[model samples]
Target: MEVLRTPDQRFAGLADFPFAPHYLEIANAGGPPLRIHYLDEGDKDSAPVLLLHGEPSWSYLYRHMVPPLAAYGHRVLAPDLIGFGRSDKPAARADYTFERHVDWMSAWLTALDLKDITLFCQDWGGLIGLRLVARFPERFARVVAANTGLPIGGGKAPLPFKLWVAFSQLVPRFPVGWLISKGTARGLTAAEKAAYDAPFPDERYKAGVRQFPLLVPITDAHASVAECKAAWQVLAQFEKPFVTAFSDGDPITRGGERILTERIPGTKGQPHTTIKNAGHFLQEDQPARLVAVINGDDAA
Candidate 1:
């Protein structure tokens, strides 16, 4: 697979993203080795708090949430999932697949030998991260699911999701920054907007971004339907500390948090919150609340 690495200069001077980049190459991942970029902060030996982002956004999405969590005595590790952010981007959309995404992340997790994880996943982050938890439950200590879900392909896609899928494919230029801004409740500033656009200098670098929405399992014939069903089997038995922190303004994943709260054995009495005045990217709309939830700071 031909991969595109964004020019490091494109990432320079990014507003609010001050953490240095770290790399780990995934060897034998179908084709050439791909370097995954991540933000590793706070105490190295502290219990890991893994932050996973979804489509069109990267570790940069967690810039506001990372420092406080790190300061709260947790090692924060936020990674750019394969094609987004500073990670290597596969040149063609076909090179991106839901299973391959799972495999790549599984490799990255083992490579770091990270354990006793606290997962805060959103968007496609939940799609891939939840699978990791099901496949390797021992690695996780707890889960805080925000604006994400494990969708079984037996049902139809939500109307908003279907429209998003269509828009991603048909749009001439994949506007990364604009898309992120649109998803958040409050709009982004000029500099903040540019940072989201930083990873993809051009259209060729956005293949993964273009393909992520389509990878969501919405039909019985979808590529990931069977495995997603299998993952659900594992999750149904998950009794870890699970909490949901969905926003009030996202129509796309409006009712997704219920899947976890109602099904997962872990969420019996946990505090699940609806982030008011927030949208799909609550990290942008409600960063303090997100950070508070991640750090167990309910007072916020």
Candidate 2:
């Protein structure tokens, strides 16, 4: 496992992102050393809110909400998963796997000694982050899931996800940043678009992007199915507080909130919301509404 770390110099002067970078070396030359980058905001002793981002996006996805959450007197920690943002990027598309992603993030959590955490997960963030919660429930305090799910691939995937999988495989250029903006209801500004594009300097840095779509467990027989099934077993028994705040316009994961609401015992009686005027990238389109959900003030 050869580890490749992107230099801090490569990420200098990103717009609206001035948070200092923190890295953890989770895996090493005994194999490939996995480097994970994260942003730590507010006082370290404050109650911790763990924010996780999904495919093609990094911790940068949480830029807008970080300050508000910090202002609310909670510490915020957002990590750039291996292969995204300022973290180490593996060279091959085959290097990324669902289980690997879980392990990468789980290691980061353990390294940071984060516990009793409130989790805000979206997109792949939910998929990977939920697995962390399920496996290590003692570490989590509460959860807010948005536009994400833990799919064990037992049935047909939603059509939009299937189309995305196909498009990711077939597209010649695989516009990493453009796809993110277009997937949202309001779209991104030229500056915001450039922020998303900052991580990948060229095609070489996009192995993670190209690999992420294929990593979704689309069939029941997928490799990570057993682990996800185990996580589901744990989640079924979860009695902690859980909430869902999904965007109304997200065709890709519109139905995922129902899975958490119905399956997780913790979701009972919680104020779940469907944010209007937002799409798959709800955090980008409606960050304030997302903050409202975190604060438990979204029209409960």
* Local accuracy of candidate 2 as per-residue lDDT tens digits, 16-135: 888988878886323567778899998799879999999989988899999998888889999998889998888777788888888888888988889879999998999899999987
Cα lDDT of all candidates, in order? Answer: 0.92, 0.85
Please, what are the lDDT tens digits per residue for candidate 1 over residues 122-214? 999999999999989999999999999988878888788889989999999998889899998899998998999999888999899998888
Query: How far off is model 2, as Cα RMSD?
Result: 1.5
In candidate 2 the C-alpha lDDT for residue 269 amounts to 90
Best by TM-score: 1
Cα RMSD of all models vs. native, in order, equals 0.9, 1.5
Model 2 C-alpha lDDT versus the unseen true structure: 0.85
TM-score of 1: 0.98
List runs of model 2 lying over 4 Å from the truth.
28-30, 298-300
Prediction 1 global C-alpha lDDT = 0.92
